[model samples]
Target: MGPTPSSSNDRSERRKRNAKTTIQSLEPDTLCMIFALLDFFDLVRCSAVCKYWNTIINKSKLLREFYAKQKQNSTEFSNKSTCSETSLKTYLEELAMEHHRVSLQEGLINIDQWKGHSVGFNQCRMKMGLILTGKGDKVMRLWSLESYKCVEEYAVPDTVPLVDFDFDESKIVGLVGTRICIWRRNGKRSIFPSNEGTFVKGLCMRYNDPEAVVGCEDGTARLFDMYSRKCSRIIRMRAGPVTCLCLSDDQLILSGSSLGSITVSGILSDQQVATLRSRITIGGIKTLCYNACSHLVFAGSTSGYTSCWDLRTMRSLWETRVSPNVVYSVQHLRSDKSTLVVGGIDGVLRTLDQNTGQVLASCVMEGNALSSSQNTYGATEKRKGRRLSEGTPIDSIPKSARPPITCLAVGMKKVVTAHNGRHIRLWKFNS
Candidate 1:
């Protein structure tokens, strides 16, 4: 009953041929559907399996279409449910470690210092290797990090305390009072509709679109088209006096209000997507930052609490208490996605691990206490109608109070924080 060796060999070949024929007969759509689940490397290997498979998977149009659908599905699913805090923490930790490794490989250095300044910092921006500081002075100061010197200062007329400023790829744009000013690299300034609103609280530019989102104290968000210099869309926030705004990668606009509430809206469709409420009763929401890569949104409260929300599932992720004093500003570091820098009225600059909501480093300004005591003494003397000895200028407050850290921004290689003292300090982090 034994078969011949030649027959056995031929049977094996026939089986192999039939399997190949079965794979080749699959519709291209079916094949692509299966391929979509695999990662890039796996897809590459699958394309090399046979000519039929290669022809389908390697086609540029097919690959694009497949990935687009996959992305849309992923986004929809992410919005459906929030990931657990435990999972997010672990994921963030891994991301931080990876960032550190990359930083080391590139030989980057992280620097921390108490750059002497009296007033609190309001906002900061970095562009073309230059750091720009915006403060309550209604002036923007430029600093050269390489030279470690204050280079120049641009003054704004009738300054109403610079709230926040953002730099495009080319120029720096600042929101002074209710006006938006564009500053060229050469220090030239141009104001847009100077007499329009009362105050500008937040600004955001769409990642792919040439439009910027501006939030005002009037409780409305306006979309400005950069090319046409026109308002394209206006959105109404439920909680008026929008304190902060952020735009997600998919063009979803998130705005936090003075009422301690967050509202999410779609930019293209102009629809109210979701609303997020905080657990702690605080003064108001002072800041909001979105991490598109992790699908997370962070909202900072005036009471020194920073809360994280899962953007995908519209659920609260976690919350961490920061300074005892009010948190005026919060900036997420891109170099390490897990790191968030919080500036508080307590005059402390604290670095937080976003994953666990843990404080990693705390820098205190040595002169803040002395400055406060001096202010108290001066105030008492003034009440008594007596001229006290000369006290330090309010701008000379030490770096510790971390006051007026109203704005924080990051660049490809550095981080910048601006204070009310008209000072901007630059920091670099190591791998």
Candidate 2:
């Protein structure tokens, strides 16, 4: 009953021919329609099915259009990717510039050394391309930062050295003995009270336009109106002799006394707002600075400790000893306040983290580069045979004597430090 082999073979061959009716047998148009319905990935997968399907997909007109569109889309995607990459690169570059840590990593480059004043500058302020420095001298000199030369000299009437001085573009104001002296840029000099008083001997002074605040020896801060030339108010600390003071635009006065007490009071208010309390007294505060943007007060003590207190919460933020001796100054740039620059009797310039009180960078005067510069300067002055008789002679100062940092001013990419000696050093940060 079984079928013959030839007959079975013929039946098998017929079945094979019937099975040839597949997707490959579809017309070019139909195949194109089907391929068009598929996404690019599916189309690519279908192309790999067999030779006939692949050839039709590749050669068909409609499918060729799809290929062209896909190519164009790929080109656009590539362009978009490149544009995005370029934009990201530019953004990163700007971010690097904005938060650059050049001073932290590279230390500081001592770019130039010069004499800042006729005497050792105890106070220094820099702004508008000029440096104003005074050592309680009879004259406070204005030195051009670009030229490194004294452009103008402001003289006080009396021979008594100024306690402190401040200047703007219009005029220079200082506390000379018991008198408040002011000199206009136009060569006009004026003294308030026009007389001396025992209670008015200023230890520190700060000037804002139309008003000046002086921390007096009598444990009070005296506010004087520059326009009216009269003492408008006196905020008494009653702690000890006021040694240092800071002024805010809104009439806030923070005065430090010799008895290690700091008081915050407003010129318009009668009572003290708050006293900045410190559990560990590090001698009296030698310098005080206020940052309006942060509502923070910075103080340096005679025993080399520098501290920060937040005025908003009336609490201490941080306190760290920057030197073994007196910390003469504490400052931070307005544009960047994450780091504090502390210079003191140790003759070291230190950059500290504002948040954690960590030492980020430090610079000393005894390096090889500094020694070379000193030697070169001395040799040049000797060759010229013109010794600067003003102040302490820079060439005559011994390299072994590392003078204390008396004052400092911070700028865009540079820091200027004045020592107890007459020399000043300009330190530049790598860009």
Candidate 2 per-residue lDDT over residues 272-326, each given as its tens digit? 9889977688788888887776677888999888888888888998888777778
TM-scores, all models, native as reference: 0.61, 0.69
Off by over 4 Å in 1: 1-121, 150-153, 159-162, 193-209, 365-404, 410-415, 427-431
Q: For residues 290-368, what per-residue lDDT tens digits would candidate 1 score against the true structure?
A: 8876788887888778888888999886788775646767766553566666776665555666666766665433321
Global lDDT of each candidate: 0.61, 0.70
Poorest 10 consecutive residues by lDDT, candidate 2: 379-388
Tell how far residue 92 is off in model 1, in angstroms: 17
Q: Highest lDDT among the candidates is held by which one?
A: 2
lDDT for 234 in candidate 1 is 83
Reference-based lDDT, residue 322, model 2: 71
